[model samples]
Target: MTGAPSPGLGCVGAPRLLAGLDRMPRLDRTAHLGVHGQLPQLGPDELIALAEDIELRGRGGAGFPFARKLRAVSRSARARDGSTAVVVNGSEGEPSCLKDTALLLHAPHLVLDGALLSAAALGAEDVVVAVTRTDVEQSVREAVAERGPAGRRVRVVRLPERFVTGEGTALVSGLNGGAALPSGQKVRTSERGLNGVPTLLSNTETFAQLAVAARLGAAQYRTAGLASEPGTVLLTVAGSTVVETPTGTSLAYVLDLCGTEPGQGVLVGGFHGRWLDPASARASEVSRKSLAAFDAVLGAGAVLPLPQDTCPAGEVARVTRWMAKESAGQCGPCVRGLPALADVLEDAVRGGGAAALDAVRTRMAVVRGRGACSHPDGTSSFVASALAAFPEEFRDHALGSGCGRRVLGALPLPEDENPERLVVDWTLCKGHGLCVDILPDVVRLDADGYPAEASMPVPGRLRPKALRAVRRCPALALRIRE
Candidate 1:
């Protein structure tokens, strides 16, 4: 289950998570123990205190405070007679992300230590590490096997590698034996998750970072990076290479080291992240606050400096279209508004005049904060930033002129996945009608309200709807064929 850790190439100044990785690329049990030493033994209060002292924040896109989350779950568990669980989110589904993959593949034990250690502190019975890649799962599973009884408490699970499937609720649903789609409902994982128990779910990097902080303690850990946000962060540069640089490192240095030139602009964060002009990119640092000041987020730490040769307008249209398709299809804003926004942006690229530009703005407004999840708002921010980031290129498109450069697919996208079928487990099925309601065109209820067929061939376009139906079936009978 162990594999060679993915070594980052460019600027990995003052590596923390990847400490000793260059010499010891493959961190097996012995190497992990030798390098990082044993995980600190801390009680619930001490763990929360250490997290607060270090100012630990989730490295996931949202950047929620780690202490706040721990406190919430701890309080919820105490209120519920002291029962809880922990989930380590290793589902790095973004094509523009590899930091989590790097951490999980190379330093699996660090991530495990964080999750398991936290579980012990919170008195949680279960520790689940949800991953998307096979290599990562295998690596972590091997790491778990090394711990014997402790490993028994850890479960390595794989979810559908969809973009939105990384959402905490989506991972919870998948682990609960439902489809990996975010429910339109707003249920907090801290209160009820994973078998309807109070659970602490955080990103892969967050846990790994937590492990690093626990080992270093408060004062020593604060030695690196900014005083406020002390520590190193893993940046998935341009999607191909991963860099574990300190928090205060210059964004330009990382880009330059990765052989990227901020030509038109750099896309900070990932698809759901915002764009920054070249000037802003030069001014910003790796810290979250630095990027925020420039109206961008260090979300998922994905930084892509645009190449000068590609048409900025065309590239925006393509990425916007992809983001739209990646939607969960659970809300009206995403189901319609996002696709419409993409269409208008494409129209603007094709010399569709100012009216087309106005149409794009209109759709952005329509979708903003209107979805069950943050997809609509995030997608809207991405498009809006594109408009402001590259004014000249967009102005050319708006005035019925076009940027002469062709779209070189400067932004990377994931390859197509193998086609899958939907099947109902006969044991779980009870002639449920929920699937029928969601997929009226494809599925029909029998007189007894069971599916007409045991299995159905789901088309690519309607797969999201089918997945949604599979999750909503109270009987848990509907399942996507593996």
Candidate 2:
């Protein structure tokens, strides 16, 4: 079967955003006369009960229980202080995922309500919504304006679109007026978030669910979904061929969606996520625990179906290369390790010897859990999962020749319009050739004597050397693409 049609509000075809619109309970006009009726204020105990009843897990890829996170913040007496804060992370940096943007755009009230309710429950006086500088910001801004007074108290902050900039810590840094990057030190936002206060930060959809939970008591919220994981989830579906089967397509498309048959494969949870064969995933349910049963979860709600006619191995190689580049370059292991893993994956795709596959396995083991952040771990997961899920494709490429098809960019990038590319301005070239000496894999000296071969795969291991080369180049001809 083919993939389902693209829904509205970032969902492929169905109106996922409008699912609970009419179902939302009417607000008490007397209590909220001056306040926007969009938000339904939830009590603390009710919120906890609702979360436990629905078993709502964090939508920020980690799949941690919402109740657990709440307890963590609530356990601390410091949470009672007005210094505590609630942050709505609308910065959907994962290129393959558009569910957050959908929530913010078409269902801003739901997201805002969740944030406001979370603040009230956590005893936080301030709530901030952090969004990318792109289209998401405009939608949230309009939502804030429509709410009038209630929205005024909720601050909306715009952020750069860097891939890592959307990480929880990075978002906190941005709100604190620092550069949009992860900190070198180990710090939890709950301990010190905006203005050095306890913060409850979560994905936009998580907050939307929170709002829903607050409105419907825990018992009612638990009515839907499995006992381990109650409630619906938002997913951005993509693939070479759209699968019409929809086991996890949300309420809007659940009736129309059908699940893919056996033998098919899909990329779940975006770039940092994993790949699974439909055959192996036949029994896989859409819940967090169900996916985890298969060593996978509905990460950040992204599901991409791969086409049978397309080269899965080639696709993996292409994405692996991009993943290597997305690293923040803060940690040495991530900066250097991901590129090495990507190269090995690429070699395997290009019909390289068994050594390539062996090298990938070895390097993957070394890179996993070594980064200051989760970048290296995520990259390793994507690679390792692809290898496990698509053994046939890997074997084919290894035994035979190339996959034959050109690398089609099925996966999205931080800047799909303009992918990162190396550039060298020859006008400034004094032929110092320090770049050539430093990054032989990326740059080489040509017949003209000046360094040429500007375009090359940037290996993670060579990033420091490459950066050194760029810095040492007196002429400043070499520049890394953003």
Q: Pick the candidate with the highest TM-score.
A: 1
Candidate 1 lDDT, 170-219, residue by residue in tens: 88999999989888788999999989999999998899988988888999
The lDDT of model 2 is 0.68
Regions of model 2 farther than 4 Å from truth: 1-17, 20-39, 77-82, 184-186, 239-263, 414-482
TM for every model, in the order presented, reads 0.84, 0.76
Model 2 lDDT-worst window of ten? 1-10
RMSD of each: 12.0, 8.4
- Kindly report the root-mean-square deviation of model 2 from the true structure over all alpha carbons: 8.4
lDDT of 2 by residue, 349-427 (tens): 6566777788889989999877888888888988888888878778878766655543344554433444344567878
Per candidate, the number of residue pairs that clash is: 1, 22
Best by lDDT: 1
